[model samples]
Target: MNTFCLEVSGPFACFTRPEMKVERVSYDVITPSAARSVFEAILWKPQIRWRITRIEVLNPIRWINLRRNEVGAVVSTRNVQQAMNAGSGYLGLDIEDERQQRAGLFLRDAAYRLHAELALSPKANDPLVKYAEMFSRRATKGQCVNQPYLGCREFAADFRLVAASAAERPAIDETRDLGWMLHDLDFTYPCAPQPRFFRAEMKNGVILVPDFETGEVKS
Candidate 1:
């Protein structure tokens, strides 16, 4: 029952994990609390439990008014053939090009919708509030009850995990695993160290936070 916080901002979009095949994408503007809850829905925990308690938007919520860029409509030849294949299951590369292009158009439209919603709101000065309002509006407009498109300006996630047993936990230096890589140069060495945030536990779930500051990790 522990709670976490997430803050999101800047040209943000949410997509299901690559492994989860899905249809009918939706969109939403949400608060940290709501975001956390949604995140846990996709990622959850038993040994390491976390929930989103609150969320704050850091940038102006601009609803993207996106139209299909003609360039995007051209599905790769490979994708078209695969879409017609029978063994590809739900996710066939054939639809990738087309789906990707359609996604781009949807994002553009969603961004414009967000911006328009915020423009009419009196609290537009507060980017977080504006984004939340926009999300709520989209969620309602899209009639997306379980899932919706999520776009935020800047998003932060505050989380907690079960503290390792103080005694069993070794000193930081001694705890180093070969998984951590010091640098690209180190990759040439015997073994690369893993990230400090890497977790060995199987029960933990990840929260999706907007990378507004970094401008990386697109939806």
Candidate 2:
């Protein structure tokens, strides 16, 4: 089976059931890229192929934010162990739960843009931004304004994924606002969600990445 790996680094936290309090927690993970892609397509398209295998954390634990508004505080976990400890802080939740919920933010954001890009203009180079703007409008409903966090240090995640056969993935519908879907996701913050990713290959391998360019360009 074709597979890819995803690396995501950022603060992770869990919200109180229905409270959604932003917490300070950080972590990192490397897992099957297919799984990451599938998680990305979660609310957007169920027809997509990709399943998470395992998730490994890499970093130190730390608390960052505790906001509860449109731009909730962004936090990062020191490492997997810290995240696990935070997860354990909760009664029935585990470390993986925290990671899933934290990942939900990125997944929702990416999925929303992916949907808009295919619907409005698949040819657009920056579909994610376009979709994010669209959601910002709707986010005003619950006083939760969808603020743009592109390059915003406050809310950012460093993640990578591996996948195969992009053709197998289904296109997203533009007529929908995936922001709400993300908002509805169980990992709305403070609530630990089950992990959907895991480790793939331990050691890194060298690759001769090709620099193919038919046209010559001047710097």
Query: lDDT of all predictions, in order shown?
Result: 0.29, 0.28
How far is 55's C-alpha from truth in model 2 (Å)? Answer: 0.6
Over 4 Å off in model 1, which ranges?
14-28, 31-34, 37-44, 68-92, 96-219
lDDT of 2 by residue, 1-219 (tens): 222333333343321222234432222111122223323432233222223333322332223434332332234444545768778532232444344323222211221111111122344455444444333333323222232221233444433232322333332222211111011122325566532211122222111111112121111
Q: TM-score per candidate, in order?
A: 0.26, 0.26
Error of 1 at 51 (Å): 3.2
Report the C-alpha lDDT of model 1 over 10-69, residue by residue, as the tens digit. Answer: 244542222234322323233222343443333333322222221222333234433232
lDDT (Cα) of model 1: 0.29
Which 10 consecutive positions of candidate 2 have the poorest summed lDDT?
Answer: 176-185
